[model samples]
Target: MENRDTETYPLLTPLNHRQQNQTTTVVFNAESNDISPITGAGEFAREFLVESKKLWYLAGPAMFTSIAQYSLGAVTQVFAGHVGTLQLAAVTVENSVIAGFCLGITVGMGSALETLCGQAFGAGKLDMLGIYMQRSWLILNATALILSLLYIFADPLMKLIGQTKAISEAAGVFALWMIPQLFAYAMNYPIQKFLQSQSKIMAMAWIAGVALVGHTVFSWLLMLHLGWGLAGAAVVLNCSWWFIVVAQVVYVLSGSCGEAWTGFSFKAFQDLWGFVRLSLASAVMMCLEVWYFMALILFAGYLENAEVSVDALSICTNILGWTIMVSFGINAAVSVRVSNELGASHPRAAKFSLVVAVITSFAIGILLSLVLIIFRHQYPMLFSNDPEVRKVVIELTPMLALCIVINNIQPVLSGVAIGAGWQAAVAYVNVACYYLFGIPLGLFFGYALDFGVLGIWSGMLAGTVLQTLVLFIMVYRTDWNNEASLADERIKKWGGA
Candidate 1:
């Protein structure tokens, strides 16, 4: 359907320009013959559902890319499991400590790439999109070098985490080798964002799937057959990621990126400081969100019955992480779609896209909750078998399920904020909700109330719920028409729009 068609559908409630200045308010129609605000949410929700379906239509391929990216870890873990519990434990611990903390943040930095490309594509400045991609590559490459240094220091870091000498030794070896992939991880995200911003996500998905398969083959040959052990696994993982990056670059060079990719341009390096500042801000915000859980898991160790509780929480957190990655894919697509439409000066379309992304994410959240509810008893068996661990997993399943629903809205809204270029405000919201309130509450509940893993999770959920509410309010009060103009201004400043 056309965006003009969306304007024909009235908003939940009309807003006066005066009301728009406030952060939060409910506008009323005194002269209306027979309309209400509650009716507005329903009407807007209906329009939103339609728009969301359209966004998902575009998002499906992107989601495939996201799921593949996340599934690599799970596949790696499963393959390692065939080797032994120790190998499985080694891979899981290393990935959580290194990959989760490091790689996840790197990929997130790519969100800036997605935002730039999306807005440029919307403004019909296809050439600038290509330039932005190069800038992102430069930024990520530098960041990767720094992260590699950090990875080298992981052995001592793990030891500090109180892991045994043996676990730290094994984890350290894995982390050391994983450092090189910082280059791969860094390059891959910008490329992925580049493709997504152009709305050519299907190409990336196919490439990622092929890379994952190659990773599996290499893992089997190197780890199982050659007895190369953890080092072999690390090498396979790194190579596989590079393979994906190369494949994506090949597609771009072959002109699969459409006109938005105007070949590599060095001019992207001109605004180095500006790009780095924005990219760094974007990276820090995403890293905070990703590490929030890891911090809780570490904190869990400080609580009563430390070892089992931490392990159990780790398993649950891993499961949640995998699911969140899938949503992150959709969320990336949402940012691209919304930003593109807004940049094109199609406020109604951008508004419609926002509505759609939220509803689709919300529905998926509900379905995810149901899946968790159904699997509450059985899901943990896939990872470990200690009766005690299984019981803990079952106990925390409900909170995990609820978290899924909240995340559906939260991350997508964050994406919307990215598309709208409202990162500063959203970052502040994250600090207040996650750090100020959530972490402190989690400590009190987990240690003081003796609520175990669930208590820690509850604290996290409290943060998410609060964050989601604030994000929705932010999105709701967004002056989409004005942001569309600002997007144009941003492009004009770059000599594009």
Candidate 2:
């Protein structure tokens, strides 16, 4: 593991006057004699199996961590459901519409770390990870401040957006109480990517596990036993997330990542605008995808029997979110592997890794989809016992099952884009597919055709299908050689090696 690669550490360009004008780029061709490129069917199968192990090693824990963290919100929603139907609807709107917006922006913004830290770590420029992470922290904290303003005026904003007055007032209270969580997200996300890039991820999974357990107990005690209701749920969530942040900080400071973390540096404050540009690309890309579903919830708020409709849709979305964690986990793993391999200039390896990750995740998604289909009626009871909510959920279960399979494919391709540093391109595709076409079509179906909530969700699914197809084609046509070369150029330009 001691990478003594000259191309990865030393300034690879020649310093001699005679060769000063000539570049000294070292190409890590997969065809090099030292390592054979996977060619034959048997060899490719063996390579696929080997890479699957690596991919899953990263994905299994990553998925668990994602679920644990996301479950905090779901737990609060569940508790709210048990309390009363109104409380459940209130929490769903606030979480899906309000917090979901923040989630898209912050989580997406922090993903810039996946690109920077992943590539830097792959290049053996380990010292740069901390600086990249800190720079992300600064940019995202500023963004979070701007988003907090929305939370402050959430009620008016919702009413302006055409939500019911009663729903707006209740959701506003939940949103305001959830403000502290924004700052936690700002710090926690970059930390997650930074640790993940270096293959130091179990700490994240463990911390999340603890936080989820705490969220459940605290939500019950404070929200139910103490009868603090939504406020208690929000406060407990805030504390739980911060606990992960504090734990991760301690892990780094404890010298677990001797290669990556070196305390804090002023370098983090330098070249911020460069980081901002990439962060914004990721932010826009994520916001577009995440808000697509939240839009569904928003449109549902306008339907007849709005409360019942919103409640069912929210529960279904939670189910999707839970299972989607597996794909998200694969997304993270493939991002790291591709970025790392590309950074190391191994084109064939990176391509092979992507293939393995995609197939493996797709298989898992299919299995999960089957489970949802089989248990459609039984599963809704976990969130709410109301007969009407359950009935609406029954109607949507088929869509969720189908969407789960699509969800697995889309995120994996997005992961490939992230690893390849194509956030800006992906962002453009997202806007065109999800917004320019998807939303308008969804509106026509929902209102014009009077298909209601199911119509809106179906339209959103179409957008996802289009987005996934485009990304698949893009990935299929990618020249792995060019990607490796570009990764080298980007690392050098960033002064990594």
Candidate 3:
């Protein structure tokens, strides 16, 4: 092993040496030299242990933060359910359809930061993290302005899609109240990816924890106690998300991020066109995935028993959302690891990290799936008390459990693609598998075959399974060494290295 000069390559502490101008070479042989079986096995164990520790170090906190933040809406929905099934369905449509559309775009656009910041941090180009974050914020906020129109017109749109008048009108009112959350999404995602790149997730977790607590208190006071109803829920939800945004902003400005927060600059504006293009690709990729499921809710609204179908589907999706958060944590962790290692010219390390993360996340998915199956009958009570809704949820439990397992593995692969800056390619894959193939199959089963909600979900799950397999193959065939060189080039092109 070569000795590294800490001053020259401060972030590559674990790597043996730094690559200069994409020309310097470092050898990393994967094959074991030891002839003794015992010695090789011992070395492999140590390596696995070390990688697992590094993965969980980031994943544990990231998962907690994701769950805490996601719970804001979940908690609101729970409160709405207790208010009435009508209130619950209204909130569900607004959330799953209206807000969900904007979330897909904003979070997707902001994910461009994950690629930029993760690689920049790995390459020891800390200053680029702040600039990339700013660039993402600009694009996402502008996009939010356009998406606001959706919230404004959610009522008519819901009705146009065959939703009941009562549900549409109520959901529209809730949608209007939740517009502030759109902008909050714009700011929050970039800040998250920015901090995530540098492994500054503990602060994010803390902030989210505080926000969830504050949100619950205010939700109780305004919604239940003060009789604010949906209005109260919306108000508290908006405040809680913005609170997170403001808190993260304050943290960044306080100089806690060192070189990564050298204040704002004009550089954020320098590469607007280029940024928009990547942001758009990312937006499309994520929008396809997020909207794919949002379609389930939309389709459910057209069912005979619209309210019951929507309510029950919403509950299943909510449970899926919670489980997805855990997978997303692993997704974020693996993305950071891959990009950082690639940026630091450690191809072998990046590949190892992906393997470990996939194994860990898949195991978690299996465990959660089993738990949901074991307690399937009881879990829907948390979201609804209506017998019809509960019965429908029970009927859907098997499909939901299968979704949990597939979705868990899917996000991890998506993370790998994101880390490798393969958003453009993945966007096309999502289109083919989700829209062209999955949605049509679902429509056929759900309507043509009269399988109902179960049929629709089964079709969507098939798409997810196919998409997951495609991503798995893409990851399997990736040439890590070539990817490392590409990361170096991307750093130089964008980070001015």
What TM-score, over all chains together, does every model reach? 0.86, 0.93, 0.93
- How well does candidate 2 match the true structure in TM-score terms? 0.93
Better of 1 and 3 by lDDT: 3
Every candidate's lDDT: 0.71, 0.84, 0.86
Model 1: per-residue Cα lDDT over 1-497, one tens digit each: 22323433221122222235642222222222111222466676665565555576557877777778776777777566556655665676677767777765686677777667777766556677778778888878877887776578777887797765665676777788887677888788888777777667778878878877787788878888998878788888877777888888888899866666777676887876766666766777777787777677667656666556755776777777767766776688678877776665556667667667777778888998898898788778776656776788788888888888888778888888788777667778888999999988987887788886777779878988898899899888877667766776655443342
Q: Is 2 or 3 the stronger prediction by lDDT?
A: 3
lDDT of 3 at 406: 92
**Number of the predicted model whose lDDT against the real structure is largest:** 3
- What is the TM-score of candidate 1? 0.86
Q: Each model's RMSD to truth, in Å?
A: 6.9, 4.8, 3.7
lDDT of 2 by residue, 295-352 (tens): 9999998999998999999999998998888799999999998887777666776888
Worst 10 residues of 3 by lDDT: 29-38
Off by over 4 Å in 3: 1-42, 492-497
Which 10-residue span in candidate 2 carries the lowest summed lDDT? 9-18
lDDT of 3 by residue, 1-497 (tens): 22222233233232333344343332233221101222366555665666777788889999999999999998999889988989999999999899999999999999888888888777677777888888888888988999999999999999998899999999999999999999999999999999999888899999999999999899889888898999999989999999999999999999989888899899988867777877888889999999999999999889889899999999999999999999999999989988887777667778878888888989999999999999998899888889999999999998999899999999999998888889999999999999998999999999999999998999988999999999999989988878886885765554343
